[model samples]
Target: MTTETPAPRHETDVTSGPGAVGAAVAAAREAQPWWAGIGFAGRKKALDAWRVLILRRADELVDVIRAETGKTADDARLEVILVADHLRWAAAHAGKVLGRRRVPSGLLMFNQSATVEYRPLGVVGVIGPWNYPAFIPIGPVSAALAAGNTVVLKPSELTPAVGQWLADTLAEAVDGPRVLRVVTGSGETGAALCRAAVDKISFTGSSATGRRVMAACAENLTPVVIEGGGKDAMIVAADADLDAAADAAVWAAMSNAGQTCVGLERVYVVSEVADRFLRLVGDRAAALRTGDRPDADLGPIVLPRQLEIIKAHVRDAVARGARVVLGGTESFTPPYVAPIVLADVPEDSVALTEETFGPVLVVNRVTCVDEAVDQVNASAYGLGASVYTGDRSQGRRIAGRLRAGMVSVNAVIAFAGIPALPFGGVGDSGFGRVHGPDGLREFTRTQAVTSQRFRPLMQPNSFGRAPGTMQTLVRMMRALYGR
Candidate 1:
């Protein structure tokens, strides 16, 4: 229902309404059967060719991403690289993960043979986010395509060019029907896709919007995988390496202008080392600069409305008595926002309770690591988190205690890069997974088949069984299960 148009000024306005979205889904549905019938080896070859095209034209894709999202060239390039890696991984692993496999028929059906396999859903709809536009959407798209489903991608209105570029390159790499298509518009376009007759929908955006998407999909009882907003946290222990922890905190908080869904929004440090850790973090955050310059460490805030939210969070924190360790409200200058670091922020402040989605970090001192864990788990979000400690065992123990779906020990956002790990969140952060084996299966429907090898000694399915047959079965069950 949003009316805002956030694309850059020079970009042409291109949008698709409900009619066009329906047409696209229809086309994809027609093409899906052929794509699936080709089998795993054939599909892998096509995907590999597409991967090569992505590598060869990575610079062009990077330019499109930067123009739409206002991210640095390096940041855009990293996103491209990660997307390609996921595409490659999906193409290589889909066969083993979703192919047919035999299973035991069990004692009750010993005379029958059983097998299970993952079959492609007819069509999948992907509604991607503007932040990390290429990387996030490609994860689901590639996995869906690998699992033999056609996809209709509805990119965020702010970043339609990037989505079109992906679809175009894929078409050029593989000569076939339009198995992948891009539909560009605002929330109306996205809602249309959700309500369409697609077999499944994969959505990445705010938790509030996610609820709406779920409601629309409910009309048809269609399935969905929602990856929503996050208020991620970082914990620095008393025995942690202060230098490493500070460095990780700064990069994770300030990078991408703090628009990352899994970025560090808060930090909890034990009081014993809070002073030292705060000093290191303040120094690193202060040194960072934001601008369009090639040497700048950060870029402008992409969405106009998000800028206001960032400003409000800082003002609320300061009004609530949080001490500004580095930049404050004055750091914001329209599109670009300098990194801001706050210490001893009130727990109830919006900066601490909400998803700031800006380059602001709130560091609070805790009495102990247990107290830190408690505070981190208090938030409604459970997307991702990090723990730093000199003792590896202690770090692991803390990681297990966090309520987030993904946790990194002595590292920041490390689980995202590994292709084998599932990515998603819990609570307001949303559910369902994308990446690894689970991701491959997300776009598939499980099919279990059984064949009767021979007739059973007892005809339990028959209506007229001999009286002695029932007594014999009872004795066998007692002999097998009685203790």
Candidate 2:
């Protein structure tokens, strides 16, 4: 979850029309053969070069991202840094992780030597979301490139310039049109890409849109990885650091105007510390200012349509008897929505049940850790959750019970910063992953091979079969089974 506030009302400058989608896929098709011809090591070298380039041009890239997405330049810098780290990690580890590895043959196949290798799945189609556009798109691109596949990426309509910038920067590292290309546009363009003859489709967006992408991919039987929406939660225990938990919760919930996927949308606190946690979190949230300034901790919503949705959620909660602890509704800030915090919100309210992708958080109080875990797991979305406790064992124990792809104990949304950790979710949150070892494998297919080392004296299926071979097989089965 990169940004959390509702988006501002602004016309998109570079959304791709339906006709342009066909042209982009047509271009990708033309570049397929050359991209596939590049062997694994060669592609790895190119990816390594791209990684270096991104790192060297990190500041400039961050500025572009911040300008496009309304995030602070410093926050954008962090995004670039993580993206560079992923590129470096994928390049360095691809050879070892995806390379051919020998496997032991069982006694029945003792004469054969076996091995497994991961190979690319031709051209890859990636449909990116507006939030963290560069980092999200780069994950699939890096892995696919490292495994020797061409890529055609379609970034969100909200931020096409950054998409163009990324494609232009990456083109310098790799030759040919098929290696890395950009197709900028709206949902139709994304749908067209999915329907094209691409071997795989990687999409990161809302769960509702993810379903549409998946349905389109089904037309070609193309495998897909959907990094969909998340309604993540944070658990505050009685023994938790009220100050730290409050700070983390406020920052996680309202940063980027609380538009992060794994950000703290809902917080569950023990009854003993509920008031203290609420006061602290409310104070911090109130102190935050959202605007188009460099000093502001929060930024305007990137998409204008998001504002209506944000308004609906807050209104629904208030109508259902939830108390607004802080800012609720502000007007005409050019896509900026002030941080809103709700307490005692009903469990079934839209703010609690569904994903409120704006800068609003619903706080609930639980009697115990079990109850907290239950509330956290009650939601259909389970991308991530955080637990704050001084006792490491208690934190782990509660974390173990929470059904989420990632968990942060005594921290908030730090999992994404660590390139080594797998970033994804289970159930409705989405399938597959986009970072760590899992991300690398998501773009590669496993190929297993076997070779005969020596001829057996008595082959199981041969011109001449010995009676003793059958006897030996029977004896082995009997010995193993002990029947």
Candidate 3:
């Protein structure tokens, strides 16, 4: 974890309470080995139980998210569904991925039978962001538990109520905070959780704070997985279904109040269809609304500081000669920042370079598909990318060139919803993956074993090795590698 100051955004002050965070950390540490001792089958049973509980009471869970984040009930429901999906996937696959499996011994050790297993890495600390708290935390929490490690999760202070709800529900299904537990607080609490006696830390938040979380975890030399902010891009090819592309781009950008890490922040459209795509995108953006109302398309920014940051990016872009194709130079409403789209923006504008994290999109025009791919790849953050095209080969080519962790062709942000796909970013967008089999192994440590079933015919361990033994070994090596 770096000592550098974190970028200003929304955070909580929950760490200051009397022994609140300390007790949470102590309890989690105390219960660590107990959870780890449960073996894979035991842990899976607990996870499955919790999954059923969550599925049965999903509406209540969504209601908690709705109260804390102010997102629509539907959005909250989606979060619950994502969590349930991950829990179910982890439960169903944990055994197959982590169980000890036999492997063929290499030629050098042909007398021995080998097996490889993924073992628990003890306790895991999960520091979650307010946005998609349920889904984000569980991506790590469920996998960690399924991998047979205890977890201590610190939910964002802005949404402590949701954290409490998760803790309560898990407690009912699992035993004594062994499998899953939650701690509520601001950065200090999260930092404390990082420094707690844990083998690894998982965080989902801004890159700046992610740096801080990494630094804190480094104090214990603990490994970390960060799902940080992204300046994701969506490409619109000339042959694309303009209406579908436009709708997806708008929805991806504006969903979750544009607070999604993989939200469509930048759009690159080929000049041949730029005008038509622009009109469609603008129409979709114009029809969007931001507020606390249930019927509204989106909700307010979770943190006031986030609103300031969004406003600053928009202001900086406008000053740098960018035209606001949609809402721009918006009035402050304390929480809600209206969705905005900027066009003809300079490449160096903050709206294009930095993560606005508000309901904003910066659309750029490219002369050809090559230019479109180049523009989409020209960013420090590469979490996710989407290319809309009728040509399958062209879409795959564009996706291959974009330096992102995940890419979707003819879809906006659909890769994340797929349980089989790995999720994480490269560069400053953060590293490591969650979801799919990759995610299942992220929380596990590989343990290799070799058991000698019989005495070797050519006893290399003995000093009485005959010259014929060397000849035999050489023959074995040659036979294996010659092909």
Candidate 4:
């Protein structure tokens, strides 16, 4: 008797370099029509399946996240939990957000009936970052999937396995393997995805890379969404809660080892409470521990190369006469960086002007909230801001004046948790929202349909119109909108 040889299972790498992008995009486009034809109800069922699996198996997702990113389990948990929440929200809300809506035809087109609806763009490409590997791409992917567009995700090479696992998990639950796929590779893969034939590209990473993504997409005249780097600022008003503000600042600056784009990097406290706020914040920062231990409050900087940037920023700040109120260069122990708080930092220091992306915070004093608002708006990065003020009216007033995309009146990094709030930035920080109704619509194209319901009194559209019709239309235009 002859022994039979087992057949080998094979898989293709859709992330080998520039070549992978085309295959990934093609597969997604081919799958999109059938998936979209299922409409909102079918999509909701699939999304619900994904949400259920993600929540039920959160522990498994957390372990994978920790293994890939080196973030503490708790920090990793937050990302997975938030991703589940977004998937739930997208499933529950996409129907209403993308449903057809009727609108008034207005005076000039009174005889017409008009309605508008969002249609899926067929395929979408997403380039994710390593800091929040399990969470970041899900934002765009969920939104796109909910909108009926298949997605091709290129996760950061640092966390490709996590990306693959995520795709596999969702596909296994919904039996929609072709609806979503992962392409794991370096920057070249991302650039190729942009150049590939896709409806749109959503990128989350440094602003420098965002610019390149935009350039690559431009080659195909493809639309792009970017969530770029930020040097976010915080303001502590004179009437604010010093203790609460300090605690929030320290947590925001040190959370996820300060790898967050919207994390606190600079603070402008009113002169009246500057000293007290600085003392409270410095003490809290100094007390924060960094390690991979289960009980550790903070984790190491996940990206190995980010260490140099962190050290360089600290050195530049010190050279510019910034005083370290807490940890200094000594905190540059490899892998982990203890919380560092600087006081009396020059306005032009690198720590304040650039994204440190580490456990670093710089504090400055302002005479009043107005000056603080102006200073915060002065930064080229208009991603997000936090304002701690006792008065609601003052908080609203200052929040309105800030140029950032989102502002938390009395909290830090609170907007990102609410699934209905559109999260994005203005200026160099990046454009295109990734949550709420706007986010769902971002993956679709608008189609306005108009039908003539009746004959209008003007009848100017017909060549057979009366000679005086043109004069009457001109008179109406002058009466209604000439001013």
Q: Weakest 10 consecutive residues, lDDT, candidate 4?
A: 1-10
Candidate closest to the true structure, highest lDDT: 1
Please report how far candidate 2 places residue 94 from its true position, in Å.
Answer: 0.5
Ranking the candidates on TM-score from highest down gives 1, 4, 2, 3
Q: Residue 85 CA error for candidate 1 (Å)?
A: 0.9
For residues 323-402, write the lDDT of model 3, one tens digit per residue.
88888766357688777888888888888888888788888898888887777778888799999999979899889989
**Residue pairs of candidate 4 with colliding backbone atoms:** none
- Sorted by lDDT, highest first, which candidate order results? 1, 4, 3, 2
Judging by TM-score against the true structure, name the best candidate.
1
lDDT of 3 at 419: 79
Off by over 4 Å in 1: 1-9
State the local distance difference test value for candidate 4: 0.87
lDDT values for all models:
0.91, 0.81, 0.82, 0.87
Model 1 lDDT vs. the true structure? Answer: 0.91
Each prediction's RMSD to truth: 1.7, 2.7, 3.0, 6.4
Candidate 1 has a TM-score of 0.97
lDDT of 4 by residue, 349-434 (tens): 78888888999899999998889988999898999999999998989899999999999988999999999999999988999999
lDDT for residue 41 in candidate 2, whole number 0-100: 70
Q: Once superposed on the true structure, which residue ranges of model 2 sit more than 4 Å away at CA? A: 1-16, 20-23, 26-38, 175-178, 330-334, 481-483
- Those runs of model 4 whose alpha carbons end farther than 4 Å from true positions after fitting are 1-15, 474-483
Model 4, residue 181: C-alpha shift (Å): 0.9
